[model samples]
Target: MEPQKINKGDRNKIYFLVIVIAALIGTNAYLFFKDRKQSERFVTVSAEKDKLRLEVEKIEVELDKVNALNLDLNDKLVEEQKLARVKIEELKASLEKAQITQVELDKANKQINELKTFVKSYNEQIIQLQKDNLFLKNSRDSLQNTLKNISNKASNLENENSSLNAKVKTAAVLKLQSAEIIAFRTKSSGKKVEVTRSSTAEKLSVRFTVIPNEIAEKGHHNIYLRVFDPAGNLLADEGNRFEADGQEMQYSHSIFINYNNDNSTYVIDWANPKPFIKGIYTVILYADGNTMGKAQVELR
Candidate 1:
């Protein structure tokens, strides 16, 4: 390297070039950070909007369920449902924005809370109406029986001729001689096999036989099946109720069969949508307002 004398003009030019390069680097870094923060904000807003939309969807589903119940909804509930629909549409429109602010998110949350309140009140009213209707029906049925008894006393001698035949019904109740239950699981190819583990079991098959009795009535019979989990909770697709032993009770499944005084086997399948627990399950079958049989199954 040869040592050369540097002029003032050349030194000034070198200083200017260094300053330009530093400025470009600083500007690029600032721009990169700003873009990253903006992207993160957009992602957060999108996630929040998705969560809010799910809440609205839940309310919409509940509304559909109430309407499908076919209950006689009062004026207030109907109006509330109408308001909920309108608000749901409004929220959908608000969430359609590409960028949602904190204020908008808060507002959507508030609206969803109000919609939840409407759904709760709507459900409570439906329950109350169902209970009232059931009570009225039971009372009317009881009164009619009472009136019939009072009016038929004058014909007691005539009724005595059929009393023997009527007494036969008491002995006509169907009784189960043997019952069996099995659990199964389905594979990805849709093949099913018996399973011993609760988590793998998806369905249960129940087979029962009625005891042969010469005096038993021959006609249609309704059999209600109850399956209780290890926690004593009934597993049912829907909370269907029926009268058994003079009381209304929930059933897990139901079957209908015809009896001809001959011992015959019947089969019914129960598919529980939820996962089963590993413990003993109690299954009780009922027919003719009496417990026909009870069986227990334990899973690993």
Candidate 2:
């Protein structure tokens, strides 16, 4: 077959078509490569954003732990957390951009590091606070124990002083010695003599000498005398009672005497109330709530 040759205008049109096709293919290849590079950058940026989010979440978890401590800095912790959250949101928005420069990434990382530092500082504060609280508690307990010990000692001392006072009081009681009871007869001429018989007795006499006591009070004291007949009969003024040895006792007679912390003699005389019985009479003396002495007299 003989080939037909194309004219010059048609050839020029074919050359333009070929050049346009090559330019279209080159443009498509450039667009495709540009889109692929942008896609890769987006994936890297997305990964970095997710990683930063995880870091923020980790800091939030640490904040939760510190909050559970219930420390005094909890209010500040909350405020710091609020600011950190805002910063995290700002970082999230920044990282969401299609392209992040190295400087911008460095700034984001710096913000994250500041947040981490805040958490670390908060943890240190909490630990130190706990240690301080423990120390204060120990000091308070120790002080209370010391006060209790002092109180106990004071109470013991008070009791001991009271006991000593009681002993001193008991030791200061007056005593009598060399005591005697006698029966006397009074003559018409105002003379007194020992009775020859019980019927002849006109008066009963009691004599006692106070023993010297340095601690006993020096003052006028009443000496109580109790006279009992041998038949257990008390010859005394009826219903005449006084306190002696912590009990009420009847006294046949009482005599006033000045005691000067020295041996002092005293006498009490009572006219025979009735005829004296012919037997032994017992005489008991009391002074200062104590049985001072006892004496006896025989009459017939």
Candidate 3:
């Protein structure tokens, strides 16, 4: 009996020890799993923080580029505005110059019309004078015929009248060549003027010829030439002598022959030290105190 009792107590003790060991192992496994989960959460949070930092840096770089581009665009816009302003000013000045030129042109046209009217009046007066002279000749012939029938005293008178009639016919037949402009040629400093893209100083040379009449007298007569710019403003050069006529004229660099000669040519040169812009240029010439011809030239 004593031995049985001791064996039972030993079995109970072993079972109790097995149960306690199982409980201790379960608690240890729970603790280890919780620690591992916390470590994984910490690693995830650290990775997310690093990614956000990189994204911020990229955004900052993009913003800086955008700011730089804006600055460049602003500078370009300002430059464009400045250029536009300058162009506007230039346009205004050109407009004013054009207005003044128009007024001057109108005045010149009026003067030209007046000159034409005067020429017409002169022609009418000459025709009237010729008619009167013819009438007088007829009346003198009748008187001479009557005198011849009466006596021989009209013989010397008839001879004087005949001589006077011959002189009148000779004077009436004298021809005058109308002043005419022949040709216009342009030249630079010493050579022919040419357009170039490069910025350089240049000169303009004008050459004109006068057409003379066959009956022009061989005497000293003054010849005049006038030049105007595209805007109709007088382009007078140095060494030009002013003469009769309501002409604000500058003489060309050279003159060839006097009036009352046959077909003489004249040349004038103007030096422009500034760069010439591309445009149309107009030139006019006058001879014998009248506008004889005109020409147009294009420079590019």
Candidate 4:
């Protein structure tokens, strides 16, 4: 075996060829593993980017919806404000109408109060007039009886002169009962009297009778009435006449009575339109220039 020994140069060449082959195989395996790892990393990064883009798009859509809702809410607020203003105007108008109605109601109440006062005054005047009418009818019956007795005695004395002279003396001494006032009231015709509220005028009816004695004369006798106001001032007559207490007064009313039967009633209606003060009034009656009777009346 020693005889065929190999040369050193050939052995070196063989070992160098083996090293080259090993280096080539190691380079090919490293290149394949590095490429595969790079490809997988790229795929993972692409998927992550897609996921982030989708999430951003979803957030933008939600923001748009929120903006639309905000706009709708703003429009609703504007409409509500307008409606509030209109309601306030209507309330103001209603309040003004109510105030006007209240004023009208107050005025009507005042007018009603005034009318009530006027009606009360009218009723009082009617009651007083009725009481005076009953008093004048009784006084006229007594005066007629006195005149009949005197006429019978005078007829018997017509034939004898001395008896006539004696009869005249008897007549002078005999005192006959004076005329009595019967009733006094206001009247329109024969009916009971009524006064109109606006006219302030009243019609007075006075009735009386004269009672004759044994020597009573049968003729017309004069009767007069003097009216006094609340202040004791004499009432003026509508007719122009200037006289007082006997000389002929500026205002005087008179009546005449004729004796007939045992009794007779005389009625005189006097219409007066004078304004009377509210107080007590006096009426004085005179027959044959002498005071016969008096009456007092209140005029409120």
TM-score, per-candidate, Cα-based: 0.48, 0.61, 0.29, 0.32
- Candidate 1 global TM-score: 0.48
- Say which candidate scores most in TM-score: 2
- Residue-level lDDT of model 4, residues 138-253, one tens digit each, is 44444455566666667656657677766674453312243222223346565554443313435444555544554655677666666776788877566744333357654446
Off by over 4 Å in 1: 151-300
Over 4 Å off in model 4, which ranges? 1-201, 238-251
RMSD in angstroms between candidate 2 and the native structure over all alpha carbons: 5.8
Local lDDT at 102 for model 2:
66
Provide C-alpha RMSD values for all models, in order: 37.6, 5.8, 44.3, 38.5
lDDT of 1 by residue, 1-300 (tens): 989989999999999999999999999999999999998988888888999999999989988988887877779878878988999999999998877789989999998898898789878888898898889889999998888887787478568757866667656667789988889988999887999899888888888898887887678888899999999998875669888777988899898888887777888888876888899888899888877888778888
Cα-based lDDT at residue 298, candidate 1? 86
Cα error of candidate 3 at position 128, Å: 47
In model 1, how large is the Cα lDDT of residue 42? 84
> What local lDDT does model 4 show for residue 56?
36
lDDT of each: 0.85, 0.82, 0.51, 0.51
Score residue 86 of candidate 3 by CA lDDT: 53
Clashing pairs in 2: 198-300
Write the residue-wise lDDT of candidate 2 on 1-300 in tens digits.
889999999999999999999999999999999999988987887787778778877877887787687766657656876887787678778867877776887788889899899879877877988898889889999999999999999999999999988777677777765878788987889898987478888777888787778888789878888888879788888689998878887889887788897676788887757778788888888877888888888887
* Model 3 per-residue lDDT tens digits across residues 1-300: 455455788999999999999988998999899999978865765554444334334433433443454332346445543553453344334333422343443443354344345445544554565667778889999998887776665666788788987665444332222222222234545445444322332555555554445544455544444554445555556767664346555754334355544455555555543344455555555444545555555555
Better of 1 and 4 by TM-score: 1
User: By TM-score, highest first, what's the ranking?
Assistant: 2, 1, 4, 3
